[model samples]
Target: MALEIHNITFDCADSRGLATFWAGLLGWNVYYDDDPEVVVAPSYPNPGMGLLFIPVPEGKTAKNRVHLDVAPDEGTRDEAVERAVAAGATVTGDHRKDDGTGWVTLLDPEGNEFCIERGAAERGPRTSTAYRIG
Candidate 1:
């Protein structure tokens, strides 16, 4: 038998709070929310992707192993950066290229790293390192 991924869980200090942040960012409603735990994006009437939040101490430090990379839904990458900054996300750094071949990496209100690439890059040609298996 094979396994399927239902959701992605994030270890956080407050499940409900963090879930609120994500729900706002993703425009997704709260699937389930309480004091200690929160499950965003419940399957409900249909299947759903999980965005779980669990409580933990210690604030985030250093880099994240897994980060969310997002491009702007409207306007250019720079515009998106402004929007993100306005949304309470911190600017980790700016890596835009002269030729517009780069993206901006951002940190959430809780210090989670996520990237925003231009729509062009999102749809541009991709270079793969995959090898065909015969």
Candidate 2:
């Protein structure tokens, strides 16, 4: 037997709001939205994992041990970061390197940390090649 992941749930103060933010960020659609919970996924009959937001009594007090790292599907890293900021995300740390590498850490509306990395187009082509020697 094998197990498969269904959804990644986030315990939040406002499930609908958090789910809205995530849905907008990921360009996913909200499948369900009730008082205590909200579910967002790519589409009906989606084969991949979805996001579920559940209401919680407590607020986030410390840093998140687990976080999501996002890469743009069409634009540059800077563009994605800017969009996130515009959507109410706060920049917690800027880890981008001068060499155009590294990622930026950001806190979502509820203070959940996530990262933005360079997109495939922004990274361009590899400058060096790897070789194996025995």
Candidate 3:
């Protein structure tokens, strides 16, 4: 038997707006934002990892319980971070280790936490942020 992740869903305040933020952030396109309760990926045939944006209104009082640790598939780590920063995301801070093993934590449009870093294959140096799932 094997375990696989199907989708990462966010209970945000606005599905459409948040979807746009993430769509631009991850180079993902909208699946379907026409529905209120759900929005599938419209821009992709199968968004490798389905990113869902659902609606919630509690207002993210505390920090996120789960966070994404993302790697850049394009160019350098610095370039990847810049792209995210330009796409409606703000850098919370840098949390790299003295060994250069840390990640940049950024807040999405609705203030969700995610990270950007170099690919594990290259491993020139690595940076990681806190991440867990239940």
User: Which structure is stronger by lDDT: 2 or 3?
Assistant: 2
lDDT of 3 at 39: 44
User: Could you give the candidate ranking by TM-score, starting with the highest?
Assistant: 2, 1, 3
Candidate 1 versus truth, CA RMSD in Å, comes to 3.1
Residue 89 lDDT, candidate 3, scale 0-100:
84
Looking at candidate 2, the ten consecutive residues that score lowest on lDDT are 29-38
The reply for model 3, stretches above 4 Å from the true place, is: 1-3, 37-48, 97-100, 120-134
lDDT tens string, model 3, 1-134? 66887778998898888887776766667766357654445345655567778787688888899998888766766677888888788999898677756678999888999888766654664467777766
Cα lDDT for residue 88, candidate 3: 80
User: How close to the true structure is residue 106 of candidate 3, measured as C-alpha lDDT?
Assistant: 90
Which stretch of 10 consecutive residues in model 1 shows the poorest summed lDDT? 41-50
* Candidate 1 residue pairs in backbone clash: 7-50
Q: Model 2 over residues 1-134: C-alpha lDDT tens digits? A: 66898988888998888888988988988766345778888887653799889889999988888899999999889899999999989998999999999899999999999999999898887799899875
Sort by lDDT, best first: what order? Answer: 2, 3, 1
C-alpha root-mean-square deviation, each candidate: 3.1, 4.0, 4.9
For 1-134, candidate 1 gives per-residue lDDT tens digits of: 66787778788876777787777666566766346767777346564676878788887777899887877565677877787787888887889877767888888778888888887545576676888775
